[model samples]
Target: MGDWFQTIVDVQATPQEAETLAADVRSWLISSGIVSAEPTHCVLGADVGHPPGPRAETAVDPSGWSVPWHDGLAITVGRTVFDAGQGDPMAVTCPHCSTTTHLADERFELKYEVWEPFREVVRGWDEGDDIVIACPACTQPVEPTSWRWTDDYFVLAYLGFTFWNWPPLRPQFVDDLARHLADHRTVLLEGKL
Candidate 1:
């Protein structure tokens, strides 16, 4: 199985905007010294995978995915996540009983207050939305604001960036990125490998 621990942040923007944002992020990485000078560039095309470097694999594969980016230490920007795998939702705290349990945990039974949002983006999340889950311990409804739905990544619509082997991005980073892109509607998505 592919074993990439990806941290993806989806930006809400158009294709043109996404391209611009990607370039800006690349420059930021270089200027911030997170990436060294003379980093290489590569086009991710075919072979159903993006190899870890500038050279593209010529082997024929059917994943039908392609994009371009600077190798390593920079975020990969794209319109769609493309072949993103699902993971368990971030752990949630039961507000009714103050019991903490993962959303995917069997011990915590979830009752979707509004199932539509969860259905539309089963593997996606946004911080602005209210948490719609019940507490497992007390079997009572919990205030959405009292629960925390934290995770490694979140998937937003319109645009996205993939960070490989990087530190978890802070809230300020997302806010700043959206500010730079002029797209405040962003979300995080965790893609399982």
Candidate 2:
């Protein structure tokens, strides 16, 4: 199910906030009996504008309530973030569709790399399955119900084979390589630690 995890990924929001939300969700999952118990581990992989800070603060209402309203199957194909020693494309044009998307200059200084393997495994997506993504980075024409933009990353929820893209949070995506990750922390209150 590598493709499943890769495709079901999300991004945006302060890393601390995202991690807290993930933890809350995990708690809910355990309390609801959907999972075994207080998740020993909860992982939330996301695309962010920067690497997570050592001491990022979380908000009071960090839990994202929008999930119930949207499908989780979404993908964001941002311009590849390359390393300092590499030559990254100034702009990328989708070979299959000839659609082009631009990248900002800061992304050049940032060490960005196309983690397709991570995307593939986390979202469980493989090629040739009608993977609907955005035009250049993640150009997949999907219903609004399928995807959306949260803070900075694209939040998507897919049903079976259908794919979706989330709307941008406020300002349009600032750059191509801007991505972040939120790792989950588990706490046991009842059973299954």
Candidate 3:
């Protein structure tokens, strides 16, 4: 089976503040006994990451499995594009008129004509270009980051915390983490890779 991961992305963290916020959040996690202070090669797609600490169970839902199957937390800092690691997003909902534009057809095939525009803009966004796409429905300019993707399939952020193969994290735990993130808006993106 493929490895599963859940990433909590700080959507509002600016590029300049990302490193500091990542360090602060990492410290909080370590102090809370959610992860170890030392980094190890326990995470996927990274050279090192903090492993589960003594009180790791405190971060997960009590009703769910508490034993971790794989690795631990990997904090990514910088301009990056994070997704479900599966495929293209099925659709995107514009924040302007609450209009959802479908990127896939009835047969679950990606509609390149519709997805191409988003793809180009997302690429530019990842490259540190401030780009906005006009809503196909409302004809209003909208930042790609403000648009919600299906299943949180796209997260363009400066900072992200990836937890690999851990049990379902408690909602309270996520909230606490967000508080440590200077109360910035966060998004959870989960999928198997």
Per lDDT, the best of the predicted structures is 3
Give each model's whole-structure lDDT. 0.44, 0.27, 0.89
Please provide, for model 2 over 9-70, each residue's C-alpha lDDT reduced to its tens digit, 9 standing for 90 to 100. 33333333544444454444334432334212122233321211221111112245343212
- Model 3, 1-193: lDDT tens digits are 7788889999999889999999899888999899999999999999999999989889876475655455999999998898899776899999889999999999889999999989887888888886888999999998867888989999888899999988888899899999999999999998888
> How do the predictions measure up, each by TM-score?
0.42, 0.23, 0.94
Off by over 4 Å in 3: 62-68
lDDT, candidate 3, at 91: 94
Q: How many clashing residue pairs appear in each of the predictions shown?
A: 4, 46, 0
Write candidate 1's Cα lDDT for 1-193 as tens digits. Answer: 3333334354345546667776775565455554444544422222222223222121112143343323343345443333345554445555467676554436544435433333334233233343454556677765432343445223334455544432344556556556656655555543546
Where model 1 places Cα greater than 4 Å from the true spot, the runs are: 1-8, 40-71, 82-158, 190-192
Which clashing pairs does model 3 show? none
Order of the predicted models by lDDT, top scorer first:
3, 1, 2
